[model samples]
Target: MIHFKTLKQANHAFMLLIFILSSLFLSACSGQEQTKQKIPIKDEKTKETAVPLVKEWKMPISISADQGEFYKVIGWLSDQQIFYVTNLKQSSHLYLYNLITGKSKLIYKTENPIVNVQISPSKKYLLIHSSPSSNEGLVTIIDSKGTELLKKTFPSYDLDFEWNPYNESQILVTKFAEDWSFQLNLLDTKDASTTVLHFPEPFIKWINKDEIAYLNWNRNSPSLDAPLSFNGFGTEGEKTVFANIIQFEVYRNMLMTVSANKQDKSMADYSFFDKKLKKLFSFSIPQLSNYSDWLVPFYDYSEGKKQFITFKPLTSGDADTYSEGFQLIRYDLVKGSSEILLGGLENVPLSVSPSGNAALMGNSFEKIIDLNEKKIYDLKRND
Candidate 1:
């Protein structure tokens, strides 16, 4: 009887342990299933969505020059056509390329270095300026197909030139002087007669056909100097003055200029006259260490859609890495910021088509990137 009772108790204990073990295993599986379901729900929205990526072209050219070698894409006529000049070119020749038809031509080849090339607002004329080593500089106007229309030689050096959007017949050319002196010349292409506007110093800008903005400095104590005043010229050559100013720019009728140079290397000013130059403001850039590089392009705001292009050096690393390379950034002034339209290009010569639907880009390298779609459209190999 005792043996039987002991066996029965042992069996009951074994049955109790089995029941507990099965319950624990069931709980664990249920917890695991709950966690798996939660994870999918948390990420369900993202799993169904996609993120866009910025596409870029591998520009065709590989640069071999050391630091300080001069290279930049100066002008682009269209997405399929481009104009580029290099210090290495024979006299920095301006070469033209049409990528669609695979035809390239040397439009203007000269021994004198070309400082700048600009296409007229109408896209009918290309203005090329040559700064010779021996002779004074001259402005050469040519047709798109490489026919020379006319050439005008300056009495002194011309630092900058711009074509008027309102009138293709009128061009504004700046005659820069040593020690911060300059003059403005209005050249009529049709008649080839130049009208000179004498400014006491470098001008901030001409706001319109009737108004011009220029700068002036103050001589404070023998070595110390402060800003004195800002001046404006009216249609009939009338003068207006603003005191204690440094730098300025004019858009439409509004003028804004720099009043203080405490932190910024550059600032812009403009005027408010017959009409207002809206969106006119100025500020200085903060510095990195004691070294910084700044590039300022002459702003064009006369139209609804304006073009802004310049060679901006990379400021993050050693000059050796970037001296031979530069990026071309363009802004639709109507729109506020610049978009990375092209890269991996040397001497970015750009030309926008008359219809504004297409543009042409050329560099020392054969590949040209399309800014609108961010793709490689042309790859030209040198013979």
Candidate 2:
């Protein structure tokens, strides 16, 4: 071939070899650029951002003690005033502390111990309850000035009650019947009048001052597939709102429900409905490896923001160490993304501020996170 090839043929063969080499070189360079781009993205995803440290406040002298300890935060009445319970010298007392003044006032004192305390929405009344034993308890309504308005004794079995959010004068109470079924009643605080409703498996919630919504088991239904329904009952009469519901919750003005899936019993469709039971949006969450992991919604229905908070475990171990504990994540519904607020919060949050800007957390110490600022403050006792 070397002896017989013409000049033109040799030139053509040399150009063909050059074209092949050029293609290979270009491909290799492009692949290297792509690899370099991918590595930075992977690194960015894995990098952990440092949690910012904000201002720390000394635990007001009111709740701090050397011998006794503060129990749990009841709630925040205002940005500066907080309600909490404490046990000192074998007696429990409710105390209201002012953050600005660094002073605390005794709201109520008791020797039997305050089991739970719920403040009214107006912050004028406190609903206090205490259980003498496992089977007996008493509910008392007291003003912020410690004036008793109403006190009633209730049996410990199947006793559940909720205050009417719209009207402080009324409350919805539930008790178990002899057959282990639950009964719902509307209680009037002025005259102690109770009107029993003819609803079974009643989970009552006040939609407004004049309206209420509840979930009931549909025993009259012929099909087993749709055994539960959500209903609105009041002076207007009872009307079925939604059906085939496995779980439902009424938060502010929005209704959230989980519908049962016929094909896959383990799966469910969670939907948000309006007051009229019209579906707004729907989604499904994945199965959790640990059932104890919490997926909670932090929606400000008043403002109509769709946000949620989730607690995810970092490991499969029993005890969550400092470096390997549960993570607190704030998720945005619109963006479909999540941001880690805290990496190793050992315990669930105590309370989220009404404005949703801060959360109280800690086990042995008191820590407050300014959720909006992404900063945490360690609260210390001012000695």
Best lDDT among the predictions, by candidate number: 2
lDDT (tens digit, per residue) of candidate 2 on 1-383: 24324458768778768777988999999999999999998888766432222343334344556325676667667655677777776567777766556677888876655677878767788887765656665677888877888887666454677788778888777766546677677778888777887665556776656666666655665332333343445444466666766556676556776664556544445677667767766655422222332223222221234655545555333232224556666656556666788765554645555556666665422556677777776553534
Q: Tell me how candidate 2 scores on lDDT.
A: 0.62
Residue-wise C-alpha lDDT for candidate 1, range 237-305, written one tens digit per residue? 435455545445454434544342444423322222334424433323221121322233222232324
TM-score for each model: 0.51, 0.64
In candidate 2, where is summed lDDT lowest over 10 consecutive residues?
A: 294-303
Let me know the TM-score candidate 2 reaches against the reference structure.
Answer: 0.64
The list of candidate 1 runs beyond 4 A from truth reads 1-72, 86-92, 155-158, 177-181, 216-275, 278-383
Pull out the clashing pairs in model 2: 59-380
